[model samples]
Target: MSLILEEISVKREHSFRSKIDVLPHIEVPWHYHPEYELIFIEKSHGTLVVGDCIDHFNDGDMIFIGPNTPHIMKNDDLFYSKESEERVIAWVVHFKEDSFGKEFFLLPEMKRIKEMLINSFKGIRIDGSTKYKIIQLLQNLHNSDYSQRIIILLQILQLIAQSEDLEYLASDSFVESFKQSSNQKLYKIYEYVSENFQQKIDLDEAAKVANMSKTAFCRFFKSKTQKTFSEFLNEMRINYAQKLLAEGKLTVAQIAYECGFNSPSYFNKQFKANTGKTPLQKKEHSY
Candidate 1:
C-alpha cells in the first residue's frame, strides 16, 4: 500500500487577476502549482511540510512559497477541540508568473523585488514589525477588486522583498519534481511514526501501518523519504530532544527517557552522532 499525501492544484484563472483562498483547512493533497504562493496562517498550529523541509508552525506564522513548490499545512489535533469554532484562517494569494509582466521585474526600479523572489526558493518567514503590515495587506486584498488586489499583492511582495527579518526554511534538495501521487500508505506510516516516535517503534508495527510486509515496507519507505525507517524515527526523536534541551529545564538523562531512548548512554551516543554534540553541549551552545 502506497501512502496518500494531499495534492494542491494550481489554477490559472485570469491573466491579471489573482485568487485568494480563505479556508479552515485546505484539504488538497500534496501537490504544487506553477504560480507563486503567499500564505498567511493566522491561527493554526501544525507540522508544515515544505519541499524537503518539515517543521512546526504556530499561530501568526506567515510563509512565502516559491512557484512549483510542494507544501502542506497539517493542523494540530487540538483543532478538533469543540470550544474553538474559530477555524484556521489563512490567506493564500496565488498569482501567475509574470502577472506583473516580464518587464515589470526587469526594470531597475524593481531590482530588490526581483532579488527577493530569487531568495524565495528557500521559503521566507515574515517577522517583527513587518508582520502586521503584511497581515493587513492580505486582509485588504480579500476585499479589494481584481486590479486593486493585484496592486496589494505587489505591495505585499515588495514589503517581503525589503524586510530583513525573513528567514529561509528549505534546503537546495527541494527542487521541483511534480511527480507526486496519492500515498495513503506513506501518510499512514508518517502519522504513526510522528505520533509514536517518543516510544520504541518496531519495524513490524510501522510496516503494518502501511499494510505492507516488513521487507517491502523497508525498501519502499527508503525510496520515498530517502531515509531508512529507523533513521527517520531516530531523527524525529533527536529533534524533539533538541527542543527540550533548548528549554533548559530537562536534565540530559530525563530528556533521554522522555524522548524514548531506553538509556542515557545510548541517547548520548545517538545525540552526538546525529548532532555532532552531546546534549549538554547543545544546551550550552543554545544559551
Candidate 2:
C-alpha cells in the first residue's frame, strides 16, 4: 500500500502523542510521520517493515523511528483469521523534533542526546538492559505528573543514547519519501519476501512481482535497499534463523534446512558472516 502521511500531535499541550492500542489487529496502513516515535509492542506477533528493512517482531519489542520513515506492523496470518483469538497490544509515544525546544537540545549537556536523535532516522531497536529500564520508564510516563513525565521521557532518551544495545533498521539505503505507485509495488515485493523467504525463491519470481525484468529488478532493489535481491533474501533468512536460534527449539541442522539453507555448513558460514556468531553460539548466548 501507499505510504500515508500520519499526523500525531497532542492537543493543548504542544508536546507529543502517547497512547495505547489494543485490538484484534494493528489497523494502520503503511504510514510515515514528521514526528519521532517510540513504541513498545506488549503483545503481538508480526512482520515489521520499516523503510527498506523487513523483520519479525513480537511482544516486548521496542523501537524508535525517526521522522518521515515509512513503517507498518503487519500481523501474522493467524490474526487475520476470524476464528483466531490473537490480539494486538502496544504502547506508543510520538514527539516532534522541536518538541523539547531547539535551544534545549543545542546545549552542550544535550550533545549525546542530540546525536542519538539524529541517528534515529535509520530506525533503532532498543535492546539489552536499556530496554528493561525503558519499559519501566515508559510505564511510569503513563501515570506521572506532566512535568515528571517529561523528565522521565528525557531519562528514557538518555538511556537509549548512552546504551550500546541498539539495532539500526535501515542502515544502508532508505526511501526518504514514498512514491505512491512505486511504494505499492515495493510493498508487494516486501510481502512476498516476508511470506516466502523460507522457500526457494528465484530473482525471476521477485522481478515478476515487482513488474521489472530480472536485471532491472536487480537495479531497482539495489537502488531501494543497497542490497542485491539475493543478499536481501539471505539477510531475511538469517534474521529468521536468529530467532530460531534464540528460541533453542531446533538443532542447528534443523534450523538450517527450515530456514532454506541447503546445509548446516553453509548456514554456519552465513550466520557467522552476518551476526558474528555461529548457531550454537547464538543459542548459548540466548540463554
Candidate 3:
C-alpha cells in the first residue's frame, strides 16, 4: 500500500476539527497529514504501528502524533470477520500548530507545551493519571460549546505538558529518515508485510518491493527501522498472536500456525520474548 496523504479540512465555523468517530471498524489506511492529532480510543482492540514501532493497543489508549508522522491502527482479526460484530468508538482532534495563532505556543507560559509538541514527532503514548484526566476532557470536548471546547483543548495540552507519564513511541533515527526520505517506497514495503505476514515471506520478495537486491534491502530496512527484517517480521507475527490470544477463540497451537509460526513451541518462545508472557498466560488474563 502506498502512503496516503490524508486531507483534513477544518470547518469554517471552527478553528480545528474535533469529533467522535463511531464505526463498524476503522477503515483508514497507513497515512499522514500536516495537522497534529490527539486521539483517545474509548472502545477498541488493535495493533498500532507508529513510524517503525509496533505495539498492541487496548481500550482507553490515547496517543498524540505530530504533523506528517505516518501511523495506522489496525483492529483485531475478529473485528473484520464476517460473522462477528464490533464497533470502533474514538475521540479525535486535529489541529495545525497555528490553530491558536502562530505566536501562541511561543509565549513564556507555553514552554512546556512547545517542548511536548516537538517530542510528539516520535509519537507519544499517554498513560497514568494523565490519560484518565484526558479521557474525561475528551468526553467533554465533543459536546461542549465552541468557546468552551477551545479552552478545554488548551487545558488538555497543559495537563500533558506537566505530566511525567508519557512514552515516546518511535526512534530518532526512524523519525529523521522518515522526514528526509520519500516514503512511498517505504510504504510499499510495509504494505507487502502487512498483507502477507501470515505466510512465509521471502527476503528476495520483500526486496523486490523496494526494487533493491536482498543484501542492499536488508541494510536499508534496518537503517530506516532500527530492526532487522526477520526481527520486524517476528514482531508483526507476535502482535497478531496477542490479539488472537485475547480473543481466546482458538487453541495456542492454532494461533501459532495462524500467525505463521510453523512450530507451536517456537511460537511460545517468541511470544514470551516479545510480550514477557506466554500465550496461555495472556489468554487467561484477557478474561
Q: Rank the candidates by TM-score, best first.
A: 3, 2, 1
Angstrom error of the Cα, residue 123, model 3: value is 2.1
Report residue 25 deviation for candidate 3 (angstroms): 1.1
CA RMSD of all predictions: 5.1, 4.0, 4.1
TM-score quality measure for candidate 3: 0.77
**TM-score of model number 2:** 0.77
Q: Which tens-of-lDDT digit does each residue in 19-92 have in candidate 2? A: 88899988788778889999999999888877656667989899999887777888889999999899888989
Model 3: colliding residue pairs: none
Off by over 4 Å in 1: 1-26, 81-86, 102-104, 176-267, 284-287
lDDT, each prediction: 0.72, 0.82, 0.86
Q: TM-score of every model? A: 0.66, 0.77, 0.77
Q: Alpha-carbon error at 156 in model 2, in Å? A: 1.8
Ranking by lDDT: 3, 2, 1
lDDT of model 3 at residue 64?
A: 94
Clashing residue pair totals per candidate (backbone < 3 A): 11, 0, 0
